[model samples]
Target: MNEQQNKKKWLRILGNIFFYGALLLLLFNPTAKGWFLRQLMEVGLFRPQIEQEAAMPKQPAVATAFAFRDATGTMRTTADLKGKVVFINFWATWCPPCIAEMPSLNDLYQQFRDDDRLVFLFINEDADVQKAKAFLQKKSYSLPLMTNTGQVPAQIFSGTLPTTLILDKDGNVVFRHEGLAKYNSASFVKQLKSLL
Candidate 1:
């Protein structure tokens, strides 16, 4: 083949390879998608901002009642976890943003796993608990996984995947973030430590 024709053929082959490679990555690799989203956040494509509530009331303005089952099939309630810094994250296995932020959330959980003052609840919205468990096990994430059993308060989760709420010791929602964020960031840890 002539030089120009050979070059054109190679370019077409490279383009096809690139297209298929990206398709496979999107189809099968959740971690790769997570990494892509993280890169976007790093480049300021989307900033995950935490809006801190200035002076949360002593009592939760909205109902704080929520029921969920733990990993061991034990039913737990938000009321059962009163007087603790409860970190409740609503997420689903299929959510790309949720998957992206999960690693950071897991890191944050590891840092405070021993602290009785703090409680981390990774509420999986997936219908199948076994599937959710498998996903976590596959990722080797140690975050506590829970499934909503009863009515979850609208104040806590308004049908938004990857929503996170930080309740103070008094059961008051101090920080409610509705997107992916770097939960393991130093400043975020400092803010959480201050609450504890």
Candidate 2:
């Protein structure tokens, strides 16, 4: 009986250690944390509201002064994107939330990639451009990677890790969502089509 009790005690101890170890890994590891958050997103949490025309808030136009350098060394500005529906996402390589939502954002980009009226900008906030590029390549994501070339207007982005903004054809900021969101939802795609 004593031997059986000892065996049971060891099993309980092992289970506790495994549980605590995984908890610690989730807390300390950025990649693991991102994967966990992504699972939450897959389960239908943190979805952005793609409102219909009647429910859409009337947001005023913001100044179009943001400039960015693309991976191919081409300079693009909000001015260049005038008369088009622009989708801009500000993110960083080190941000777990940004990593968590990238797959959904990439899916959304793929859907509108061939549409000339719609533009997608995946702006990287990392100090190292090479690292950002490598991250995308490693993940097999073909997002239009861009880096800031000048001052970013505060109204468009205020240092949020995963800030998403949508501009109408007339350069108005029509939609803004901060933090992780599943952007490839059917409603979101329909809304973008309506804007186009």
Candidate 3:
């Protein structure tokens, strides 16, 4: 082949390799997926827009009964989190959207980790706790990780990955969002401050 033709062929091969490599990374690596999502957020995608309830009810319609075990194997429940702003996020390792939004969730967690009036629960829906822990540790996220030890409340998790529910101090569902969102947005922090 001529010199120019050989250069063109090599370029095409390198392009293909890069494309496939990125595809595999997005598919298999949770940290890569989270980084990609954060990039998208930088360009205005998945901007956090919290849907506030028109009238904050005294209690949630669905019972908030739930029990989950933390990384230290300590059992906890929403009932135990009464009188505090509880943020519950249901996610799984294989879920692309869940992985994508995790970094923003981590940022949100960092902002409130020191607050005694707020509690954040990152509930891993995957049955394998070790795999979930590995994912979090690999990403170096400090968010509180938990796995459901008992039946998850239907109101909290309706078989959806990346479902988030914010409960008020009285344990009423004040905001609920399904799918991916930028949890570190200013509006979201303002909403949480309002509750606080």
Shift in Å, residue 49, candidate 3: 2.4
Best by TM-score: 2
Instruction: Write the residue-wise lDDT of candidate 1 on 24-117 in tens digits.
Output: 9977787777888877766555443334453545446348768888889899888888888899999988888898888888988999999999
How does model 1 score by TM-score? Answer: 0.84
User: Regarding TM-score, does 1 or 2 come out ahead?
Assistant: 2
lDDT of 2 at 178: 82
Which residue pairs collide in model 2, if any? none
Candidate 3 Cα misplacement greater than 4 A, ranges: 51-62
What TM-score against the true fold does each predicted structure earn?
0.84, 0.92, 0.82
Give each model's clash number.
0, 0, 0
Full ranking by lDDT:
2, 1, 3
lDDT of 3 by residue, 90-168 (tens): 9998887888888888999988899999999899988888888888899898878888775877767788888988887
Candidate 3 clashing pairs, residues 3+ apart or interchain: none
Candidate 2: tens digits of C-alpha lDDT, residues 1-196: 6999999999999999999999999898878889999999989998776563325555555574588888798887887788899899999989999999999999998888999999888889999999999999999999988998758888788898899988888787778888998889887788778888
Clashes of 1: 0
Q: List residue ranges in candidate 1 displaced over 4 A.
A: 16-31, 42-51, 55-62
The count of backbone overlaps in candidate 2 is: 0
Candidate 2 lDDT (Cα, whole model)?
A: 0.85
lDDT, candidate 2, residue 63? 75
The TM-score ranking, best first, is 2, 1, 3
